[model samples]
Target: MPGTERSLTMRFLAEPKDVNFGGKVHGGAAMKWIDLAAYGCAAAWSGKYCITAYVGGMRFVQPVLVGNMVEVEAKVIYTGRTSMHLGIEVRAGDPTSSEKHLTTHCVAIMVAVDDKGKPVPVPEWVPVTENDIFMRDSAIRLMRMREKITEEMSAHLS
Candidate 1:
């Protein structure tokens, strides 16, 4: 069921297939999980098809090993007319244990789309709780930083 309309969480086992030669989960696999979780949250909130517009501010905090329980959570921290800014977190823990630690975190921006792939409006997200307020503010801050980085990258092409 729907615990939260603006958030989605997925849990799975980190399998050997997901591991790299270093015996840790591959970075690409982790990124794919993040994108999937963010997409789920965006689609649930918008009730429409969504496409990933951007993913950034990624931090790999720790190694996620095979046999670990992996949890990927995505929350809609902010919403624009057609875009949703998601705060995604990946956690890992031994299934035998109750504690989980953060392994990865990032921000993903998803745009809702119509059947023809045109952008469509997303439901507005309003911060109510303290954590919600903080996350929304953080999303805005990340957006500002992203704008600066884009501008700098574009200047090199001129």
Candidate 2:
């Protein structure tokens, strides 16, 4: 996604420590990758430190095995007055076969804050490509879903 407010790519080699008893990478480890990738995107977009405010629609489609190289790609999908949403894709690279497989995907919402931890407005974002448009649209859909879920939960509680 070109002209995105920010983007980041990180790679890690899967190891035994990252795996669970089943020899597959633990869900928590994958989540950690997501968090770091998203945080980096937000910080790059804001040009300052950003804090994660929420996470949504984290789905693990497949398990990554040890000895595979994993790559996480993150990009800013949208920005609000004080927040931004990052879309992340986790891909697994097979060392022996040299094949890459998308294993998981997620969206992370982050808030821009001042030194005192007060929310701050985000700067203008630029979207110059089709990939950027797709990412933005996905973020919009996720935001609407979040709103709908919140409303439903509120109604249920009431």
Candidate 3:
């Protein structure tokens, strides 16, 4: 069953407890859902315990409202020695409707860990189709961009 799970999707309904007095759900609540989905995908793919190392490009495009159904999808886009990069999305819509609007987008880097809590090797991911390749490449490019940005900031600050 190694390298079999490529994606995970979860559905939930936004409740009043998840929202503010303004009738919109807090972004942090949605982020928790994103983390859950990403963790599930990483754990399933690696077949080991995992920890979240990094979360990048978390943008909330829309606010979820009470009574709306929310769907969180996590897809494995790439993997490294110990990290699995998962592309995550959150969408929300009225339960009676067939349409959902994107509420968030992000990528999470999860590191597989051993009993000692140290990073452990994970199975390599292979792209089987053009879309798969594109997603993997996108994750690679995003990682590079983050590194470049970090380098630029460190150079300027010091």
Candidate 4:
């Protein structure tokens, strides 16, 4: 199945500079890639500049190694008045081969903004396929969970 315009895929080679002292691609580098991919998807879907409002459920399942071919895919799964929820996955494998394994997964919330940097409405997303529906539902669940966590933390910090 082909992705709609609301999705973006980025592919690149993991470089030595991305590696940590342990020789694996650093988590920060992977996070940067995730943010970039999510921003691209949100901007394309909304047809406006977007800023990351939140990133949740980020999990590093495996380490990416230098020389690996990295692929990051971001898909718009849900939407609010001004926010687009994106499901992002990062995968990596040998540069010479086609096989890839999941390295990271997360949901990012991006808010479209106007020239003045104020939040603006984004185009709504509708899930048409089973997979899309599943992703959207998952994103919603993650959002609810994040809200609960935030409330809990606020009680402690406030």
Judged by lDDT, which candidate is best? 3
* Candidate 3 per-residue C-alpha lDDT over 1-158 given as tens digits, one digit per residue, 9 for 90 to 100: 65799899999899889977677999889989999999999999999999999998999898999999999999999999999999999999999997999999999999999999999999999998999999999999999899998888897884
CA lDDT of every candidate: 0.91, 0.84, 0.92, 0.91
Q: Model 1's lDDT to the true fold?
A: 0.91
lDDT of 2 by residue, 1-158 (tens): 21244779998798899989888999999999999988888887887678999887888898999989899998777888888888889999787666789899988998888899999878756566998888788788878888989988897783
TM-score of each candidate structure, all chains considered together = 0.94, 0.87, 0.92, 0.94
lDDT of 1 by residue, 69-153 (tens): 9999998899989999999999999999979999999999999999999998878889999999999998888889888999999
Query: Tens digits of per-residue lDDT for model 4 on 7-101?
Result: 89999999999989998999999999999999999988888889999997899999999999999999899999999999999999998899999
Report the C-alpha displacement of residue 109, candidate 2, in angstroms.
0.9
Worst 10 residues of 3 by lDDT: 149-158
Per-model clash counts, in order, read 0, 0, 0, 0
In candidate 2, how many Å is residue 121 off? 2.0
List candidate 2 stretches off by more than 4 Å.
1-5, 96-98, 154-158
RMSD of 4: 2.6
What's the lDDT for candidate 2? 0.84
Lowest summed lDDT across 10 adjacent residues in model 1 is found at 1-10
